[model samples]
Target: MPYTVTIGREREMAEVRALLERRGDRLISLVGPGGIGKSRLAIEIAHASADLFPDGRYFLPLEGVFEPGLLLPTIAYVLGIRDNGEAALEERIARALAGRRVLLVLDNFEQIVEAAPLLVRLFDVAPEATFLVTSRTVLRIRGERVYEVDALPVPDEAARGGERAMRSAAVALFVDRAQAVKPGFALTDENAAAVADICRALDGMPLAIELAAAKMRVLTPQAIAQRLEQSLPLLTAAARDVPERHRTMRAAIEWSVSLLPDEQRALLEDLGVFARQFSLEAVEALGAGRAWDGQALDGIAALVDGSLVKQTEIGGRPVLSLLAVVREYALGRLREHGEAGRMRAAHAGHYSALVARVAPGLRGAGQGDAVVELGMELPNLRAAVRHLVHIGRLDDAGDFAWRLLVYWWIAGFFGEVRVWMLELLGKDQPITPHTRAVAWFFALWSELWQRPTEEVVAGLGECVRLFGESGDRDAAAMATAARATARLQLPLPDLATAERELAEAVEELHELGNAWAEAITEVSRGRLAWLHGRTDDAQARFDRATEVAEASGDLFTLSVAGNHQARLQLVRGEVDAAEAGCVRTLLVSIRLHFEEGIAYGLEGLCAVAAARGDGERAGMLAAAADAIRQRVGVFDAEAFTVHTPQLDAMREAAPAAVAAGERRGAELTVAEAIAIALPDEERDRIAPALAQW
Candidate 1:
């Protein structure tokens, strides 16, 4: 599309023109608040100058370009320049622009402020290139000329004939946006006043105006204008953009809100509380759709296209977000309708009930299904936790904290999740012991992760108390495993926690004599010893666990033993032994029809292979692991996080390193990797970030 206007500020455009004419090619910074038309103006200038710059203009969007080091590579990508490992960025820039006068439009440059120096250096070398950068704030580089864009032109409503009669910034924006949506949509006598008011009410901000205009495709201009007026922050600051009578952005927002149907309005408000983008399934939770899902399904699509929500692509699903300003408008609508508190309460209840149902269910045969379900509800669960804690529903809060642990571990959310769990364990929670056991396990895990002395002691203490008193033997065994895990996280002197639990579970296992449970308990015990720097003890327990699992035909337990045993062996610097254990686990998992187990086993085996300095072998194993993972259902970000990208990065960087070492007759050892960066250290960092996704 050819850019229009470089528009709005006549004086700024003149200044820009003067600078470009004099300097040949200079860096121009177009800075403004979001929705104020910085991007529009940059595009306009780029289009107008295309002929001046004989080389075609290039637009580089920097949304995902966070790191400064990646800037050149990203630019190279846009320019179709091959970026070899050692390519000099400035030389590439100079060569690319040598005989060409090219206008480069850079969008969202503020996110990479640290990279501005490099960009400036590029500009210095590439005199034939003119840079137009659009950002939320000005990039104050030396010799960079800045143009600050104000709102669009505004005119007096009474003097104007219709929408045409009003030459205001607010009206211009309304006309611009509405025409695009409802082709040739203009303010007539019927809606001219309404259009002016709507534009004026949304602060004549281009983004807000565009949003309101989209609404008019369904709503009359009047209804949108009126609905927007209800919210004060959205009420436009009485400026000269339009008539003073039509001023105030809050009015604009209120007008827009008034246009939506009752259910749509409700959905919008409940969704406003979300910080990041969410999905339709999340919005569906707002209505009483538990049994009546059709209504929610019916309303979501209409609401999305009306500009009330913004849809963003997220993996397989389309996630939605409200513009920041629009969200403020929706929040106001929430309070006005007195539905925010009620919806929050509902959210808390839904999540609390869900966790309670699934937490205990996880200790039994339906674990795989439970894992899948938990993954889907993670966002809702997080929302529920926030609602419960923030709204003072402590019982619900406790339920959320407790039930989320196993999911947390299985999903690999070991870092901040633990800290968050501790915060949820507030004073005198009225939740059941099973709930407390769940909370205790997470708290203990978090304590170990954060390396706190007192927290470790307290977390283990509670685990013992809960495990001893829990009436159900299966639940108690799960608690025993958790308590032992807590001990393993602490120093070696605390082996009593794992040892006592192992002994208790062993006795209980014989008394009840459940082979599958016995296998799980034995593997957990082995895990405890493994983490405590007791290699022999860990190996013996894993061997026993594997034997018990195989004897009972419990493939889950067998896989767990295999992966855990391999991990322990790797930590002990026994690469070949670890690989062997992982391979056995992989074989058993495949035979048992458990795809997830197979994925876990292969991932561990690949890590072992990498640790052993077998680059080609490790790559093959990792690829096999990834292929299996894609075929198996991914439960949650937590499950996804266990496949550490750091391991992947190491694998990538190690190919040549491994090949060279091998050629020199030096074999890589697991101990060498251990000395570099512990496997746990990498897993701990990557897991939580993955879960958040």
Candidate 2:
């Protein structure tokens, strides 16, 4: 009997064996970088795990289809379910899989995160079905075991000819490869080092090693290894006739890219201008070069098929994402088309304006995109910043500087946003007044949430000075207002100075007869008044602000003033009034899909519910508020959702809160916290004061 050729990865092989033996979880993911032998390893593991799975093994390789929505249908098709899409495919598939100990290997799934949840749900229902998925990243669902595949090992030069301690994934690959090329090429000391270097340089990723092995016929091991570092594009297939998908990284991307149409291909290239990920809105705006009408979703579908653009399931919505490598390819195309430099400038201008308008909306006292929309647009917005810097639009770059603070603070994009922002903005720029001012303020605001108080103060001071020279009076006033509030809340800025700037801004707001500006100015004034123990004065100012906001009919100002009112109510012990304000705000925010509005609503509702000792209610509201946190996309502060956590948290919390306790956490106070917590319409309907203490 011919012994089975156990390819590279003794360790991974053993782990897969162990996982199969346990058979605890229904789904297992074989995840790693491209060409890391995920498919081969999966096959071996599947065969080995055969005994554990008494049912038949079925394989569904999603090589061409990138639409994650099609995952279930694929599975249903493989299972031989007649009329899988007719009516009860899910039910039929579930029933068919109920008792069968089936092993379903889902290959190349990273590009389809949206579909993973469907499989997860199915596995939950069908306990006997075992799913083995191969992806670059884990299929992020509950109870999914991840088995990461390392690149095939290349043994040391000196130890090459020895007994197979060459048990490394690299060594196994080298031996298997060299033998195929020269037929008798031994794993000698001289060639081992060369092979090992190749594997190591290739990040020990399987696809790279295999590709290197194929080139062994023409070039020496050393030359092949060195060449791999430079020519990844030229290296195509593996020496071994494994699955076509396992050939080369370029092949994989090409397979995915070929799926797009002319329009999508052009769009994908243009989209690469963004160094950071972006949202659909960003795509629809600056990123979209070719106009895609509603019916033209097919062109987008083509790109989705090519795997050039991958969709992310953000809070149950599909948002597109591009891998770094894909981004690189698109960028080259952008330059080829001579459209790269131009789009970058456009992106900077649009987002700069976008950030400014969206920043004030963070108060949740306004009209804006829904949380879902925000989550979907995160990648595009991030791309916007990159495009700006690459194209030399530094002055407006300030808008992003302070504007993204809400994302870092209230929205919870700290980890992702911080790294991207720091790197993108850290470049050398000749500081203009506008650029310096916006930078100082935004950076300071973000730092206050992420770092020390003193550093934030330092940045704020720089902003205050720059704003007067470069920014408009409106920006100065807003900065002044935020600065003054910070003084009252924290001990960094001079309270007296903060108060003076705010006072001056208030005077200016009245002079301009700008209701929205007046509301913002009063909001700042109210915060100061509260800080200075002028509670009554703060309430009067806040009340006036709310009236003006309503009269102006501007959603943004109304929401901001509402938060102030709710905060006041919490302080004054008017639980009912505060709760009502938040609820109103919540409704308005939901309609607008405003993440900030949702945050305020949840925070406020949690407080009111908790005060009434409704733990379930409080938890629900707090959870709802928490939902909006950590979202990516346009709402990096909530003007968009492509990445906001608001919906996800709400999905988890709302159902439970709908059932009971009123738990809003320590993030906000009973009243002021409540205002910070609740909805715009509610804030508008119920005045914070005179609702009874």
lDDT (Cα, tens digit) per residue for candidate 1, span 286-319: 5574333446665666666566676666445666
**lDDT of model 1 at position 7:** 29
Q: Report the poorest 10 consecutive residues by lDDT, candidate 2.
A: 634-643
TM-scores, one per candidate: 0.55, 0.51
1-693: candidate 2 lDDT, tens digit per residue: 112255756678787777767878668888776656677788777777667776678877664334454465556545534221212446656765766688888877876777878887787778888888888777789988887676555555455443543566666766675566567776666666666666565555554454456555557887766656555444444313433334455543443344345666677777676543455665666633354534235655555444355556644555565654566567777788897788677767666666666655544444344222443445446556656655666555445755654443333344333333344457776757766666555545544532336555556656666777774665676666656655544545467877887788778766756556677778878877886789899988888887877775556556667766786787687888886776766655444434566566566655665566555555555544543342211112222121113223443555565344324442232233335444555544534331321
- Which residue runs does candidate 1 get wrong by more than 4 Å? 1-203, 218-249, 273-286, 289-294, 356-377, 425-441, 449-455, 466-476, 486-497, 506-520, 527-540, 543-560, 567-693
Best by lDDT: 1
Question: Whole-model Cα lDDT per candidate?
Answer: 0.60, 0.59
Assess the local accuracy of residue 657 in candidate 2 as a C-alpha lDDT between 0 and 100.
Answer: 56
